[model samples]
Target: MELYFLGTNAGVPTLQRNVTSIALRLLEERRSIWMFDCGEGTQHQVLRSPIRLGKLEKIFITHLHGDHLFGLPGLLSSRGYQGGTSPLTVYGPPGLKAYLDISLAVSQSRIPYKIEIVEHTGGTVFEDEGFKVEAALLEHRIDSYGYRVTEKDSPGSLNTELLKSYGLKPGPIYGKLKKGEDVITDEGVRICAADVVREPKRGRIVTILGDTRPCSGALELSLHADLIVHEATFAHDLAEMAHQYHHSTARQAAELAQEADAGQLLLTHFSSRYSSFEELIPLLEEAELIFPETLLAEEFSAYPIYRRQNGQLGK
Candidate 1:
């Protein structure tokens, strides 16, 4: 999976950055993308990328904050005008459905596809054969949440060398072997799939948190995550102000990544005061001190999550 940052600014838009929005593209695996948060101007941001609105399968809203949801209605409407025909599902806190309902109703916009709104109270929000999502309430001004997206473990590759040694050629028997079945070739040679196939490969884990203070929920969501996207709404010097606003500082976000043993941490939701690259350096420099794997997310930047040799996640 690849993560594309549409907007990373905190609270409001700046000349350099917009607001909170991230797209998790599973094109290679699932042929679709799942959006984490849709801040204002998110649809415009997607226009700047190769992202197609029609391929958006699901949208996960962390909270009902204006910056995180103001662009949702416009996006949903545009998808209808665009080529979106498949059903879409949205997961968020209780007020989300009402907000969208009123907004769409007021505008009298027409939607071409069905939209399913799920109001979650912090638990398993979604689960399918390929992936599962778990939500937990976070400490924020509103009822925000953090989501842990985990892919299901897949069967290991078939050992071609072992199959060749058994004088087996690639065919329907190979499919049977992948299913852990013992098959006999046309030559009547019995082959055991267990002896040729490798063990199952562990799935990748990703954690994406909404606007939050350093909390246990964030830690739980980030535990052993291959990649984590956390909000850093303030600089270390303004840590007190961050606490007052129920936001996290860069150092605080990094501390959570280190404490959770996350493989990599991507920090976003930057305060608008640090609009220039130079002004944001101090905030990121301090965070690097606590977690060297911490990365400052940039708009339009794409980070590919990979499984390292140690079975941990990396970018």
Candidate 2:
């Protein structure tokens, strides 16, 4: 899986960065992409990246903030106009359905596909065969949330060589064995799948947080995550202001990552005051001091989530 940062700026757009938007590309896992937040001008950001509107299967809105959801309706409309015929589901806090309904109704927009809006308060928001998504209430001005996407463990590769020793040739029987089924050979010998199959491969975990102050909810959602995307709307020097605004400072975000024991931290939703690259370096430095694995998110940057040799997740 890969994370594509569509926009990394906070609240408003700048020449260097746009608002808060992130695309979790799952082409290899699900043949679709899941968006974290769709900020203003997000569709334009997608156009610039390799992400396709049609591939967006789900959108999880953290809050009703305009910077996080203003582009949602426009993106949904554009999805239908493009080649997105598949059904789309959106998960968010309460009042999201009303917001989308009114926005679409007022605009008289026509969508070719069905859209399912799930208003979640907390707990598991979505779960399927391959993945499960959980939401936790975060500390923000409004009722905000953080999401943890967990990929389920998968069966390891079939040991064909070991199976061959038991006189099992390449056939449908191998398929059954790969599915963890005990099959009786043509000679009446029973073969257990566990005897030949390797251990299951561990899945990856990704945590994405919305605008919030450093709180326990963030830690709970990000516990042992392979990659964490946290908002750092201010520098270390502005901790007091950040707390007042219900935002997190770079140092606070980094401390959260360290406390959560996450593999890597990607600090995003930067304040526009630090628009220039030079100005943002101090924020990065402050974070790196606390967590060396921290990275300052840049617009349009894609980060890869890799699995370690022992089946654990890393950056």
In candidate 1, position 230 carries an lDDT of 91
* Candidate 2 least-lDDT 10 residues: 306-315
The TM-scores, one per candidate, come to: 0.96, 0.95
Best by TM-score: 1
Q: On residues 124-143, what C-alpha lDDT tens digit does candidate 1 reach at each position?
A: 99999999999999999999
Which runs of model 2 end up more than 4 angstroms from their true locations? 187-190, 308-315
lDDT of 1 at 178: 98
Clashing pairs in 1: none
Q: Model 2: per-residue lDDT, tens digit, 118-180?
A: 999999999999999999999999999999999999998888888879887888988888899
Global lDDT of each candidate: 0.91, 0.92
